[model samples]
Target: MNDGAPQGWGAQSTDGVRLQKVLANAGVASRRVAEDLIVAGRVRVNGEVVTELGSRIDPENDLVDVDGTAVQLDQSKRYVMLNKPTGVVSSMKDDRGRPDLRRFTQDWDERLYNVGRLDAETSGLLVLTNDGELAHVLAHPSFGVTKVYIAKVDGRVTPQTVQKLVRGVDLEDGPIAADKARLLSASTGSATGREESLVELTLHSGRNRIVRRMMAAVGHPVVELVRRQFGPLHLGTLPAGRARELTKVERGALLTLARSATSSTPAEDAPDTRDGDPSAE
Candidate 1:
């Protein structure tokens, strides 16, 4: 019951590129397949179902989604996931002569910056990109983008401690709480006989040194910490000090999150100052 041409074909603007061509150019699908998708009513332009095969859009200005996933039309944009190794500063440049992020980004010509910070001694799952809007949405605490951290802390952790973390704790800056918390494992050192426990926490706060501060408040200071996930991104098997381009699926998910966050209430204008050394908790 569908034709290649739709009812709005005559009224559409002739100034911009066709929808199918734009989708095809963005690697969403081949031109023919894109047309089929449009005719099938699976493609939306700016939140409206657009099935007219001849519909034109400003790829740079208009938002498009195919099958509920965001279509990134700008080819110049870059999204990278880095498993940051401990001891390297999160900054792109360090004036103190410490190891920085330059080595991982030298291959790309685009100037990129870390989305959020991981303290110098902590490691894992840092996103680097030139996409400022996406970075703001993911990094700002007001947006509540959850991050998963696995912390190795001193002393044996128990259910009570986990419950307290979930209930909340008061810190110097303010009260904070983990959205989710659990004890992964606990062991006693063979030589030193000191107890250690691995605690996995899910939090949406961007406070500096938040994980360390939280554990210390509960009588178990963090000895080591690593972020395992950021929003929809997972560290997975990515080795430390390595970087890779995000897969098409990953980028689509990330963009979709950013779009959703932007559509909600506007976040505070304060800069995420947690990017500094001894910060990014």
Candidate 2:
């Protein structure tokens, strides 16, 4: 007869025990995985292995281990944003001779990488960070971090195109659309009067070549795409080829946005504001 007492439940028991958190306290894995372990009937509290969802453990008293590995919550966090320029590759390293964003920040000691990619041809605000959890939140599709783009398309465009884009259009990837779009202006220079359409599009989904594809889908075919803003951050007057670190306040705002993304909650009610002050460069 082989009887292995459950893991967290020891001779001493605490008044309150949460099965998943107990596993997390023991370093079994992340909270999500710990819940899974409990569901799988791999967790034992006080000689009795349990698969209950509501199990808890007093970290001060409970003995816990997950498949023998100890898991602990992460402490230190880091965040950074870069005003990416054209010709800079988004990857950490490229086998090709192209320059990566890392080349620009050789002096930074802290480990950081692009939170999201900006294709070699695309330019403007790009976020970089060392906080893995934050990065995960920004990269996930559910976050819906809005990205605003200023695009110049060939030929003149009618207002109907703007309406169609805002209404949503079917793409190969199913129905994808811009949250909002508008014709900023239609202009032509010199005596030739060769005109171009300047349009702004705001979308929360960060799909590959989404902005370009959407424009093309509408037959406008973007000739130039510049990301003007990302969520609460904007490129502002920052010219190309310059990079800056996010200010403490800006960083806090970003963190709040990321938290809101995960919680599926709207941002706390506050006045819509931008550029309280430029933090630093």
Candidate 3:
């Protein structure tokens, strides 16, 4: 046996290791956070902005930077995708002793941080990694990383309801709205003499409990909610609670998309904070 020694992040296995892992090793942030910084257009490799979470870099010759500062990478970095189950908090550990992501990641033996968190009652795709810089922007609102969710609500949802959600909802914190919303297959079923419909929501906001609150405001309380997609990654048949590494194709497509996004939108498109930016912490 080869003693199961893990390969280093940049061992030239295939297109170098994931960019997030390199940032994580450089002490920039955990892999998840690293993805956020990249997606927020904060990190640069070889003097180009890289927003693609799936992008890779050659640590030997490439230059890496975060918010205009260079990063020195180390050896170990891990990226994992976990199909989060219900009743578990998104954090690595739960002080209240409730179910957490750690229970599902024991075998990997890596300190992976959750990328975009899902509430305990909600379940679906969850990304865990040692890259903290990427995780920051993916979760931040300014980056506008689209996250898609499907929710089963407690009423006969109508097109009018859908329109309202797409328009906007005034929440306690502030006004919020989904970028897109649609009613899935309308199945007529008998349950309490009322119809329960499935609605799909796509939004960029990362506010707390935003999805559940949005539906409730429109008179359709969410009975069940599950995240189906995040950016370029989808929760395809990976089985609930199971974890897997990103495929090569998936990684490449994401980088290509992020790079395109950066090129399309000029820096002036960002808000008044376009000038001197605060450090991404």
Measured by lDDT, the strongest candidate is: 1
- Between candidates 1 and 2, the TM-score winner: 1
Question: Counting only residues 3 or more apart in sequence or on different chains, how many pairs clash (N, Cα, C under 3 Å) in candidate 2?
Answer: 15
| Candidate ordering by lDDT (highest first) | 1, 3, 2
In model 3, the Cα lDDT at residue 240 comes to 86
lDDT of 2 at 194: 72
Candidate 3: lDDT of 198?
Answer: 95
**lDDT at 38 for candidate 1?**
94
- For residues 1-281, what per-residue lDDT tens digits would candidate 1 score against the true structure? 12123333322678678999999999999999999999999998777788888888777678888999998988888999999999998998889999998899987999888888898899999999988778888888888899999999999999999999999999999899999999999999676699999999999998898999999999999988999999999999999999999999999999988888877747788474334223488
- Relative to the unseen true structure, what is the C-alpha lDDT of residue 103 in candidate 1, on a scale of 0 to 100? 94
Evaluated against the true structure, the overall lDDT of model 1 is 0.87
- Model 2 C-alpha lDDT per residue in residues 1-281, reported as the tens digit of each score: 01234344433544466667655553446889877887886765433566767655555434333443222223233455576777777767677978887765665677666666777778888777666656666555556778889988876778999999999988897888789999998777345467778999998775678888888888888777888887788888877877767764566567556654655643333221111111111
RMSD to truth, every model: 4.5, 13.1, 12.0
The local distance difference test score of each candidate is 0.87, 0.65, 0.70
TM-score of each: 0.93, 0.65, 0.67
Off by over 4 Å in 2: 1-76, 189-193, 265-281
Ordered list by TM-score, greatest first: 1, 3, 2
